[model samples]
Target: MANIEQRGENSYRFTVYLPKDAKGRYPKERMTYTVEGKYTPKQLQEHLDHEYLKFKAEVLSGNYVRPEAMTFSTFIKEWDKKYASKLAKTTHGNHVRKLDLHILPEIGHMEMSQINEFILMKLLDGLQRKDGQDGELSFHSKRDVYRTLKSIFKYAVKWKVLSQNPMDGVEKPKAKDTEEEYQDLQVYDEDEIAQLMEIIQNELPHWRAMFTLALAAGMRRGELLGLQWNDIDFDNNQITIHTTIVLTKGGPHIKRTKTRSSKRTVTLPLSMMEELRTYQKHHKNTREDSGERWIETEYDWVFCQFNGEHMYPSSPSNRWAKMLQKHNFRYIRLHDLRHTSASLLIAQGIHAKIISERLGHSDISVTMNTYGHAFKSADRAAAEKMESIFLKK
Candidate 1:
């Protein structure tokens, strides 16, 4: 049994005791946890109960590490073994890679308790992008490190491994070039979109259907690559996005979506659905003609090689580049097709929330951040509409 005490309005302390050995060789005190937060009385009680059970279990299970002796590296190993499995496979790999490349090298040796906001801030101050020669990191790299560290120390504190989370004291890095990135964004305007549509029509059935879906649904490239046949709803004319393809040195592998929100059902145009049916018929003929050469899997990949194995995740981008060059069309990243879809929707005065959902963004703010210019263009049109109502002309 552990003793629980209320130290303040919402602060609680839990003290755990270890049983004494017959030879009086074992220490009696195992650990003490103290945390302060805003919680209702009922919530506070639940928090205290959870803290006690977790603390008692750790001591009894011999899993408790004395706060004084615990290193960031040690905690990371424990965390990775226990909690990293919950993350998507690619995300887990990326987190581990970043920790090894940047974070672990700086603070892995230090005691978790000894690291402060200053140490963490200094560590962040030294981060740099892989391609850059500058001393400071880009907002992208900074955000990755910031989120990684914040998640790590938050878990440490939650599990009672540390008394406080120093990350709480650190300011999150902000992207300074939000407007610049928006200005520099690539999107096919209405005319270019029409031109693209016309050009892709002459392509092979599979390539035509794949790129058409990209422009129609705003799916990420990985989402398109990982899409399986069964994910499509023929009756509703929709496709469910739940998995993504990740490429590694070994080969391409399938992984679950990055966030819960990334798994969504997007309704697509009826005409495009007919295009898919045509492609499906084409695929059926290919599978029969290929005979033993066709490698069939349970996945039934919508887009694949002639042998039926899924193409390399980058294959679409590579082939898309060639197709554009062959057609003498101005080139944009295949991913910009997603932006093109959003830009076209905004041009039609589609609501931001609808665009966010269509893009499978976790929040509308993400849509706003990426497509601020599109919204500004729409807002200008809205102002002109008001002028038509109020002015004589």
Candidate 2:
């Protein structure tokens, strides 16, 4: 069924009929291969016939890797559209960024068969910094890159595009202790929180309400910003966290909470509730002063600009920095407020499960792992209490 056409001197093209289809057609999956060598027409045809027979055998066995199969670039494009489209936007964005910045630049042109553990290790080595070598990517970033690569390969294997994944036993790059330690210290002490609260109360009562809610409810900045008046239950002394204001590339977007657990209701302190009521009244007055200039979004956000437009996602963080500098207080990221709330609750002997619920963590283990150091002191206190009780007995 295959035809070998001689084009010029020492050049010929071979066309072949593939294996049987569901309709029993041999040419259903046709293939064309070029055979150019220093052989005569008869010799070239014989060689092409042998190659065609081998190709047919492999195709029948589902082991055929066509010469015109996907390149890394084409495969990745398909991956993004078909598979990665289901991922969260932020996660998908990170994957695309890593592929563009790290992975694709090196092995993008290679065929699927060309990819192996050795080639992947070489790619990892290219990302790593060694003696007399300067690489901008960190070990943690390289680990992320490796994981992304593994995910891509895993998808390829699932679709039978690749025979096997090369990242099965690949070693991950390790991050330095300094980076880990820095992550551990990303929280503020109770005294620092108290100091910040005192300063904000005296100078900016409106902001005081915001900070108090953040500390008392253990809500993330985005969750706080996304809050609407109706989401708060002053009667029940609770606030429902159903959504968050995520900072997207386009602008601030109101999206569902990161997880199902993040949609739970958290109780607020009576004092914090009073502060919110007062702030609401003041905000209403301010809006009245703005009059026609006040813009209304369908969300009816609790926290917004004077014109009632939704506040930018970064506004809280920006205000946090300036407020700390203005009050001459020690600096902490705005996110540390939530950590501070968890730490204070731990110090007060609150159960880990309770704190985890307040913080809307998907699992109690997540709360324990993140604030494990806070629990160490609580553990010591528990031991001392047990000892005292036994002595009294």
Candidate 3:
């Protein structure tokens, strides 16, 4: 039972009785209503009644909204206008692409409020089942689409445009477990590292310094691309990571580091410092020759394209793939370099906290979770040492 009682001057209290079990133990649920601006008590009651009815309807329908003749495409466009500026450029671009390629063509004609949880689930199921000429949806592409939908519903709730997020209760399609197959960290052994260095120096001379920096410093691809001459302190053998370069729909853009803690300084090895010094000399000469034509933004980036434009993160992957093929080595993702650095550091007995900071992880927990295998290996090594000491004695 619910009632509206007059409190003082245009103010009223709305109370609802929550039913209890045989034991008379029930949770309390109530609301207070205060009306302003010359609304009569009857008018306020009517408005509240209408809102209550709409909320009740939403609950009865499992939070389903009947499509209001607005197409998914139109809604997405509006959503972008309202929310894109709040997102990173790369993230915004990705959301746009996902809607255009996956969601819009399939269900853009449907009404905005009409998409129920079942229909949304079916759509995702269809996407998971889809196969291009090459075969089924790539793992990365599938995950991207799922994430996009999740974000869209999240935004709907945030903007109060939807009473409830329909996709919230829907289960996402199960993607292949590729993480174990594609190890997050792929550090080369001493021999492989030596071979890689030799190959980069001999064949991909332009990439030698980049590879060295990645392996030695564990910088993210964007952070590495965003580096500037000023960011490097040769005297101190340190590099200050501040920002990241990302590819957006409007082409490349610079953004703050992914997390606040990602903006940190990493001490470079002496060998890497020497390499950077040599690269700096060449980079300065290149910049001077290019003059005003160079794509030197306000932030003087360290690595630039042949024409002096900022290097794209994708460029490294392409280069790495070609180099891997040329050298008859297994191709690894560019991010694997960071993992390689972490693994190598752990193997050398560097503390986990130091590794976490060097890799720009927000917390040591992240490092531990991702690279806990390294700690287990360390434990084994410690046990072996202890056994040796005791057994020999």
Best by lDDT: 1
Q: Model 2, 1-393: lDDT tens per residue?
A: 325555555444545555577888766344454454477768866887797677667666776545447688888987999788678766687798788777888889998778888889888867844336675466667777888988898888765576678888677866466445236346667677667777888756556777788888888998988888999898988899997887754567778998998998998889888888898898778878998888785668888887787789898889889988988888887888888889889988999999999999999999887777779878998899999999997
Better of 1 and 3 by lDDT: 1
Candidate 3 ranges beyond 4 A from true positions = 1-67, 112-114, 119-144, 158-162, 171-187, 203-205, 287-299, 377-393
lDDT of each: 0.84, 0.78, 0.75
Pairs of residues at least 3 apart in sequence or in different chains that clash in candidate 3:
65-113, 66-113, 66-114, 67-113, 67-114
lDDT of 3 by residue, 240-283 (tens): 99989887888878888978889999998898998888888887
Clashing pairs in 2: none
TM-scores of the candidates in the order shown? 0.72, 0.72, 0.71
lDDT of 1 at 356: 94
* Cα lDDT of model 1 by residue, 1-393, tens digit: 437876554455667766777887645444555556677879977887888888788878887778778999999987898787567667777788779878998999999989999999998887875554755666667778888999899989876777799999999876666663464468888888899999998888888999999999998899998998899998999999998998743467788887888999999999989988888899899989999998766679899898988888899999899999999999999999999999989989999999998888999999998888789989999999899889975
Per-prediction RMSD in angstroms?
6.4, 11.5, 10.0
Instruction: Give the TM-score comparing model 3 with the true structure, all chains together.
Output: 0.71
